[model samples]
Target: MNVADKNLARVGSDELAANSPDTRTRHGKLVSPVITLAHGGGGKAMRDLIDDVFIEAFSNPTLNTLEDQARFQLSDLARYGDRLAMTTDSYVIDPIFFPGGDIGKLAICGTVNDLAVGGATPLYLTCAMIIEEGMQVSTLRQIVKSMADTAKAAGVFIVTGDTKVVGRSSCDKIFINTAGIGVIHQDFKLGADKAQDGDHILVNGYLGDHGAAILNARGDMHLTSPIESDCAPLHELIQTLLTAAPNTRFIRDATRGGIASVLNEIAAASKCAIEIHETKTPIRQEVKGFCEILGLDPLYLANEGKLVAVVPANESQAALSAMRDHPLGKYSADIGSVLPGGRAGRVHMQTSFGGKRIVDMLVGEQLPRIC
Candidate 1:
């Protein structure tokens, strides 16, 4: 086994402790094994949850950084003059299978999309499976195969993996965690903190389809339509944009918090004011109607296949054209631009009728399990 595989094995063994259980001599106090609501509530309770679940599942030197992200050293691409790009994410969408894809497919595509939007050529991935005790083995096999197929289609490999079975109630059904590595050309320096005055904001396709599709699967809603999740792998689109405009300021895929959250994060990171046009954002008619009826803002709903690109005015058209040619970005549009001066990192939206309003992150998530 290679370093990644060996490190993964050490982490697994650490968590599993002994092959057979010795309850009489078990170490530690009677901390409840039944997961508590406080586990998800952000606090020490949450920290304990991370320790018992995430850390125990995938502990390693790289992840020991404990930062919101991981940093590592790599010189594998010296020949191509590229800088290494790395990112990790976990998928726990309730309904594993939905309109556009299942959890297996989403896990691979989502991680790849993150690196792709960051201007990286996605290469390798690590997948970890959290399976519920009563989950059918046949179903598990199907999901794993689906994941393998998606990775193959994306030209990436599942280089390493870890699996664990929890009590049925301990998790929804199944959750997947993915870590990815990619190579970014040395000349490319895209980041959320790089937006500048007059920078254009563009999105590749209509938003909220993924969230809506998942909601529909819940069976609690009283509506139905042909709307499906726009889950797609975006590495190809990223490559096209990179080939056409290697100098993009920033690139991002709107996932859990949606486009609005992504834009807010970018603004805060770059310390710039953003002004977006309400009329310019592209939304499918059915998605618009569904949001209105459900009292949800499409802006805050999740999306898996859409991307936000910030580019210089000179290269905006070229970027848009390149994105539009891709099957996943046929509906690309310029939704907004950077403002010169205002509340640093604040976002403003211009209503079609000519009024400006502040757009803030959703107080609480509008939709849950929308990876």
Candidate 2:
């Protein structure tokens, strides 16, 4: 039988067996054999699987609710007067190791930046790893060590973790998923919708360095450039900026979908037009050449150590100065501003020659499976 047919047949057989009166415990509850994909699919099968596995393991009221998200009350003393922020990310960057940093570093930095952009001071993280069979233990050690270093640099702790192993062919060499929790200052309120017309958009640094650096590291294309990934922790840079501009509205790290996608999202969320000046947006010459030769748009490319900030015009310069003084934001610039004209929720690029064009989200996938 075909794989699909075989799976269906087994599922049918299991369902019949599960419903049979004989398939019950002494307590008279139906029993299941093991976990399956249906367990995560949120159907009758999922309910049974959860009752059999997860609830049986943890058996907590918070987890039993099975709502879209778990909510709980935190003590005001624990809050320390800061709002809570949480973020999660998975890293499966190829080669594991690459220019500037490795997948481990990316995993930690990626989630930390998410919390940072949410106006949270990242404090803790949980790491989960999936390793393929026959993978070298030494390599795993290296990745773990890198995670430790990255967390230390960002001033966060890895409070918990999990590890799983799969058949050699079932997974790549390794994959890392990290979830982070942070506390946002009481005065700092940032969200995509907080963006307003006349708000200036500032980027922490040049673009596309991470994506280009990974491509070069892969040896997929025959080109050489000193453009290493700008992968670094932004907690300090962000903290410095927050100190100067307590009234900042929103911030986001440009990662998977890059600056274009982020600006498009902010524009749509805030119902404003984002006008980015190509001339002012920094791009290393090598990156521009690489993108030109490879038919890539730097706008849609990923960045690791960069953030997009929308701040008041009065505080824009101070924020820029704070960003520039920080090592991670040394190349920072004021790239654009929120405009009321043009299509709402759209991003327009002012070309280097002084013309305008639309910048949109990545349609499918330009650089696939990058972090």
Task: Output the lDDT of residue 159, model 2.
Answer: 49
Deviating ranges (above 4 Å) for candidate 1: 1-77
Best by TM-score: 2
Q: Tens digits of per-residue lDDT for model 2 on 210-300?
A: 9999888888886768879888888777777777677788888998788998998898898888899999999999999999999999988
For candidate 2, the lDDT comes to: 0.74
**Clash number for each model:** 0, 0
Question: Per-residue lDDT of 28-122 in model 1, one digit per residue for the tens?
Answer: 22144444444444556546544554444334443433444433333333432357778999998978888889998899899989887866667
Candidate 1, residue 163: lDDT: 54
lDDT (CA) per prediction? 0.75, 0.74
